[model samples]
Structure formats: structure tokens, C-alpha cells
Target: MSSRSTYHHGDLRQAVLSAALDVIATEGPSALSLRDLARRAGVSHAAPAHHFKDRAGLLTAVATEGFDLLAAALAQAKDLKDAGVRYVRFATEHPAHFQVMFQPDLHRPDDPELLAAKERAGAGLRAGIAGVPADGRGPDARLAGVAAWSLAHGFATLLLSHNLAGPIGEQDPEEVFRTLAGLLFTSDTAQPPQE
Candidate 1:
């Protein structure tokens, strides 16, 4: 009969989170307010607080969800290059989650669930790097992993901000990333500079 009555009979927590995602996607995370989310979800203002406690709590949940999703996407990759492509795709698809995820100040950094999700994402990236064939020099896997992540994350950020639209006109982002990954991960390029 009424908005409040309808929300009360439905999934208020998910409704609030969905509304919050919409706000973050449209206006950025700084614009997210529990009151606004509650209004959007047609629930009592206090209903969101019952699930999230505060803005930081809600953002922590969003970050956790983002990391979990990223981990799942990475886990499905056939190889290191594919993992980089998947990372870019995940960022583009989940801009709201991506925005809140890396900004530690926007969410509760010490949250256990958030930490676990972050670890899972990190492990997936590391596993992808480990799958790469060694080139006799035995380059540090940790540095290689960081390189892969930086390439994907930087490319995704640039694409999301529309900075690559000119140079990459009409070219598919995933194909570009695959080529970039192939070049960087090759034996010659991956080696340390000779002294």
C-alpha cells in the first residue's frame, strides 16, 4: 500500500545497498548518505543503519563485494594475460565498487570481511603471475604481479576517465590489454636491465 510497508516486506538491506550503489555510480561515493539511500529504497531512515551501522560500514561492505567479484573474475582467467583483461573488465563493470574499494578512508580498513576479500583478490593476482613461464632469470614473482596489476588498473582507470578514447579510438580495450600484456610479459621485456 505504501513505500515503507512494501520495503518492510522485502529485502531492506539489499534495497539500501542497491540504492547506495546507484548513488555512488551516478554521483560518486562522497554523495552517499544513509538517509538518501533509505529515501531511495523507500524504507525508514533507520532501516539502513540496522544493517550497515554507518557510512563507513556500508562502504566496507561495498568494497568487500567488489573484491569478491574481482577475485571470482580473476579466478576464471586462462592465464596471466587473460587475468589482466578480466581485471579491466571487472573495474569497468563495477565502477561504483571500484571507486570505493581502493579508497581506504572511505571504508573501514580493519573490517575482517573486507580484509579477507582483499586477500582473495590479491591471491588471485599472484596466482596469475605464478602461472607465467619463468625465463631462466627467475624474476621476482611479487614484482611481476605488481606490474600486471598496475598495467590493468592503470588502463582501466584511464579508460573509465575517458583518457584513452583518443589514442585508442575504435580499438577494443580488452584486445589492447592483451597486446600490452603480451609485450610486457615476454622474456625480453620481463628481464631486469643489464648492469
Candidate 2:
């Protein structure tokens, strides 16, 4: 006597995940709940537990899913110079995942699925950075990655926070992302650290 969607029981896991993301998208991570997700997905209240042990388990799955999708997006960029834009695009497009992926306290970071997805995402970014001709090595590469990540993360965070929506207009987020990327590449001039 289950009330799960009859369209395709096979996609139930993905359906729940999708619904979870939708929930996160509107209410932020702290607001996510398995019961609500089940209701959103048109499934019996018990449905999500089959794929996720509990609410924490579901959030963990969402973070893992987010990392995997981020890996896919980074992989699609195909160039280091495109990394920032790709990063921003992923963040804006996958706000729910982006929101939870960085919150280490919300989900178990050592979860096998999360670890594996993290590595895949790291590899994708590494590959993307490799395309940068002047990209350096060691700490330089690490710093470069941090810088690019910061730029994209900062931009996407702003977008998610609704701070940038005012000025961005119709200029595709990519365009602003690209412009910022250009800013990153344009000059190395710096004054000094503030005391």
C-alpha cells in the first residue's frame, strides 16, 4: 500500500535527490527535511529512507551528488581559463549542491561516496588548471587553484545571496565570470598587505 509515484519506481532515488535539491534550493541546507522531501517527490514518507538512512544520510547524498555534478561541469569546461566561468556557472545552476558541498559540518566528509566525488572534482579542476599556459607548480599551482576557486566561489556565493542580481542584468553570469577571470589574468600589480 505505498503511494510512490507510479511513473517509474526505478528513478525513485534520483527523484528524491532531485526533490531534496529543490527543497535546499528554496530554503537552504538548514531547512531540508526527509519528510518534506518525500512529500515534494510525491512518495510515501518511507520512500527516501530506502536510499538514505535518515536526514543526515540524505544531505550526505545530496553533497555527494553535488560534487559529482561539479566534476562533470568542470570536466566539460575543457580549459583552465574556462575554469572560473565553469565554476560560477555550476554554483549558480546547482545552488542547492553548492550550498551543502562546502558545509563540512552538515554531512560526513569521510563518507566513501563523498570522498570519491571530492577526488573526482579535484581531478577535474586539476585538469582544467593544467590548460593554463603560465600556470606554475607546487604552492603556486595550489595558490592559483585557491584564487580561481575564490573568484568563482565568491561570485557564485554573491549570486546565491542575491547581492549580484541587481547589477548583473542580462549579461549572462558567464560574461561576468569571464570578465572577472580577465581581471585575474590582467595584472599582477599589488601594493602591500595591510597592517
TM-score, candidate number 1: 0.91
Return model 2's CA RMSD, one decimal: 4.7
Off-target runs (Cα >4 Å) in candidate 2 are 1-8, 134-139, 186-195
Q: Write the per-residue lDDT of candidate 2 for residues 113-152, one digit (tens) a residue.
A: 8999999999888876565445233346667777777787
**TM-score, candidate number 2:** 0.83
User: What is the C-alpha local distance difference test score of each model?
Assistant: 0.89, 0.80
Candidate 1 residue lDDT tens string, 1-195: 575584573788888878888999989999999998888887777778989999999999999999999999999988898899999999999999999999999999999999999999998898888777776676588878888999999999999889999989999999999999988886344656879
Worst 10 residues of 1 by lDDT: 1-10
lDDT, residue 44, candidate 2: 78
Q: What is the alpha-carbon lDDT of model 2 when measured against the actual structure?
A: 0.80
Instruction: Enumerate residue pairs that collide in model 2.
Output: none
Number of the top-ranking candidate, with lDDT as the measure: 1
